[model samples]
Target: MTTPQTPGTWTRARAWLQTHPRAWDATLATAVLACMIVGSFADPGHHGGPKWGTRTPDAPSLTLMVLGAAALVLRRARPMTVLAATGALSLVELVTGDPRTPVAMCAVVALFTVAAHTDRTTTWRVALPTMTVLTAAGMLAGPLPWYAQENIAVFAWTGMAAAAGDAVRSRRDFVQAIRERAERAERTREEEARRRVAEERLRIARDLHDVVAHHIALVNVQAGVAAHVMDKRPDQAKEALAHVREASRSALNELRATVGLLRQTGDPEAPTEPAPGLHRLDELVDTFRHAGLTVEVARADHGTKLPAAVDLAAYRVIQEALTNVQKHAGSEAKAEVSVVRVGPGLEVTVLDDGPGHEGAPQDGGGHGLLGMRERVTALGGSCSAGPRPAGGFRVHAILPVQNHARQATAAEGTGNRV
Candidate 1:
């Protein structure tokens, strides 16, 4: 049994032909020349048919026919010029030669070349006159009679060549258009990827700023207190120094987590620690208290669980708020943090009692408030950071409690604990 042929073999053959265009053109030229030479000697004239008008061509006539067919070798390089040369030679053969030679073959090839490489208007412009003049010359001026089969054959061949070339040209244009569209789409995808990368870098920079600023501010304040009291109250100085170490350690850990996310590949062992959320609120408050800020915490959420993203956003907002109170609100500031569940979401509010400064702008000139609002907005939540009407600065964020991948992971952790 014979095996079926696959399209891959044909595809490879077509690719090879496309790569060797000059060889393909040379092959076409050779085939047309061979046909013209063979037809010249194969006397079709018969006792009664149209071949009755035939006679053998002479030596110079054969030479002229060869020259006409040879002109097609450069048809593709200069189609119109070659077509004109071949048309003139064919006219010469028609007017002077007996038993007409097939010099018209070269003109047909050149006309096809012109049509295939040019537009419809150009094809029409070139093809109509070419067909009319060549056919009229053969019919009116050749040795053959007016209604001879040879004259009609010239018209049919030229018209067919034009139509076939136009079809090929149309197919080529369509293929080129498809290739260009594909390239444009690929460029669009690359641009989109680059845009996403830039957005991610900005996000990471904001996270690093929030983390370093909050913890470092606490460390700076505690270090200053420790130095001022080291000679007088050794115990108080030691406690302040311990708080300094703890704040620095927290900053380093949070920094590692934020920076680890920037790694594009490979699980380089950084830290598998869970992100800080409501669970760490007490510790966060204790740090503020140690830094001489009296932080009061009130909760009405009643064990309401949150998605990891909302939890983290809530944590970051509160951290940045407290940090601002420490930095902008004077030493006498007392802050109140509230976490309450309302409707389908969790609301976190941080308020202070110190003398307030100018309100934080909505658009951004302050990184802390801007970063807080961005975090909340990304989660389909609303955030407000400004001076409270009564006393000091206020930060309020209401984040929805929707189920997501983070919630699922949190649930899994709870299950594993059980």
Candidate 2:
């Protein structure tokens, strides 16, 4: 069985004292010096004075004792300096025949301060050497002859105090550096996550804008034409109404595809359908022409390739422009559509003359032009739609030519641009 713990035993003793190094140092020094003052009143033998006693300790001259007490106040600020001052005073007491055995105890306070504040290398440079010199000097030169146990006790205690203080200092520095590095790494991870999220939001916005805009515009235009012609040419009117049904169904399917982006867990399986591009321009033009608006499509000097977004944007610009003409211009209006490649970008323009109709009540919030602008701009392209200076309206768009190849090939192979 373990024995009961004592108030101040060797093992685990002073563990808490070691926690407050400076405070513990001051409290210990004051207690020890106060005890020494009391010891001065006793007889030499009764007060542990046969060898390790403070002779003449109660005498009128106690200059070294006073100096050692004053050194305690500034010990934390200048540990090594305070240690040096006390060590010098201890040496003077030993040589000048003063009665102060506890003067050697002052060196313990100095050693503790050196270990707590500075690194091992500095503690060794200042403390170990001074301890060796003072212990050796006192043993050889003090009134006590050589081989005195009291002098050797001073050396051992001072060495242990210095070692303990240095260990504490090193651990404190290591913990602080680790905390700072962890905080910096956490900040970097958060910033990277935010940047990636912003880029994905922009990408999803572009895809949804492209898929929904074109087919919806075509449906709106054809529906307008079907309503106008049913009263004049019923047979031809039925065909235009059929085209409007096809465009509306196509729009619903594309909108479903756009909404699927919200469930993006991984690589999505390819659907049984596909996206429409420029080759569909013929069918698109035919649908409007059947509706009684003459659409002339002019394509020249085609290139080998174009990006998917650019191809899609070009198709949408033409589709939206024609739809606007059918809605705003009179039934008799004739629209001219042109697709031409100039430099690295493709230009699609639809210019129409005034329909020769009177006073139209232009009204309602239409998503047509807004959707067209969104589509072209998503691909770093530009689209402009406004009333023509001649009499009607014109929509001109410039789409970069790099993405035209896949569109051209896809249109040719399908032979059905619908």
Candidate 3:
């Protein structure tokens, strides 16, 4: 008759025993000692099943059983030493006890502990000898006949214990390795995500700088012109103010588009405008022209369609180069822009005819040229910007067309560079 709370109490006791390993070992040793004592009172020579309480173990057998069970308490701490102690006790009982007790059970448990804690090579080295000596002693010297089942049982039990322990060890090692690999993969994924986020931030910063710098420069120039001509030339001043308004509006629109990338997908009023590319090159040049800077454009690209990334990179290179020209070159400086296709690559060049300023923007104080190089290099292209040997600054880039775009074009049967 068990109470309802009995199972819960047993569960808690088991958990506590597991948490305290020394206590658990002591409990196991006590159990083994009881089993050995009970077996010693059983008479195997009796008819039918063995009858308990028909025989009693001598003082020597009792002493050996006690010693063997006590040694098992330290099985996990010093498995080999515990095994040696138990094996010696079992051997003594096998050689001297007239009706041998089951003292070899402790040695089996100790062998198992040794196998579980040590490597396979050491397990084998220790297990074989322990099994051989105990089995040989029991068969040859014990009161039981040489062919008795008890002697053979010693060999079988010890072998099985070693094998079971090795199996447990192998499983433990395999699980640990899997856990470590999973942890390593998770860390790699996190590192890759952080790296990508950093790159995106740098790209957005560059876009913001380009948009604000280029348009704000125009707005400043137009506002200054509007102020200078307000009294003497009302019509000219009105036109400059209109240019100022236009530049400011364009700047706002571009800023909105760039910043909208940081918005959540469900956010309202997100910009749906496509990124500016070479298709908008004319509009870009016109904006600078409206600010009173002269820019000439020449193209030999044959209207070849480009990948969106390449087109956007090409457009930004020209935009940043021209913006530097407007800022660093004298007011009367004229800029020339060229786009040409030379075998599997597109070449873009921006050259200004202004006197070479001693500290041009491309001479490394600004993020404009640095951003340009980063964008080009990211796309596997090369960019060079410096003072030209002849006169003004030169910014040139060679962007390679990726094979995938050409392959897609070929798959479509167009037979032209894409």
Judging by TM-score against the true structure, name the best candidate: 3
What does each candidate score in C-alpha RMSD? 8.1, 10.4, 4.4
- lDDT, each prediction: 0.84, 0.69, 0.90
What is the number of residue pairs that collide in model 3?
0
Q: Write the per-residue lDDT of candidate 2 for residues 24-90, one digit (tens) a residue.
A: 7577668757764654444344444443333456443366766776786678878778888988877
In model 3, residue pairs whose N, Cα or C atoms come closer than 3 Å (at least 3 residues apart or on different chains), thus clashing, are: none
| Clash pairs detected, candidate 1 | 45-51
Candidate 2 segments whose C-alpha is farther than 4 A from its true place:
1-234, 266-272, 355-378, 401-418
Q: Over 4 Å off in model 1, which ranges?
A: 1-42, 46-98, 118-156, 163-171, 174-178, 264-267, 300-305, 340-346, 358-366, 380-382, 398-418
Q: What is the C-alpha lDDT profile of model 3 across 1-418, one tens digit per residue?
A: 9757546788998999999999999999999999999988887766798988778898988999999999998988988899999999989988888777989999999999999998999999999999999999989888788888889989999999999999999999999999999999999999999999999998898888888888888888888888999999999999999988998998899899999989886787778898898999999999889888899999999998888778988999999998888888877999999999888889999999888776687564778899999999988899999887888889999998755377666867864534
Worst lDDT window (10 residues) for model 2?
A: 355-364
Model 3 CA lDDT for position 69: 91
Model 3 RMSD in Å is 4.4
**lDDT, residue 181, model 2:** 92
Q: By the TM-score metric, which is better: model 1 or model 2? A: 1
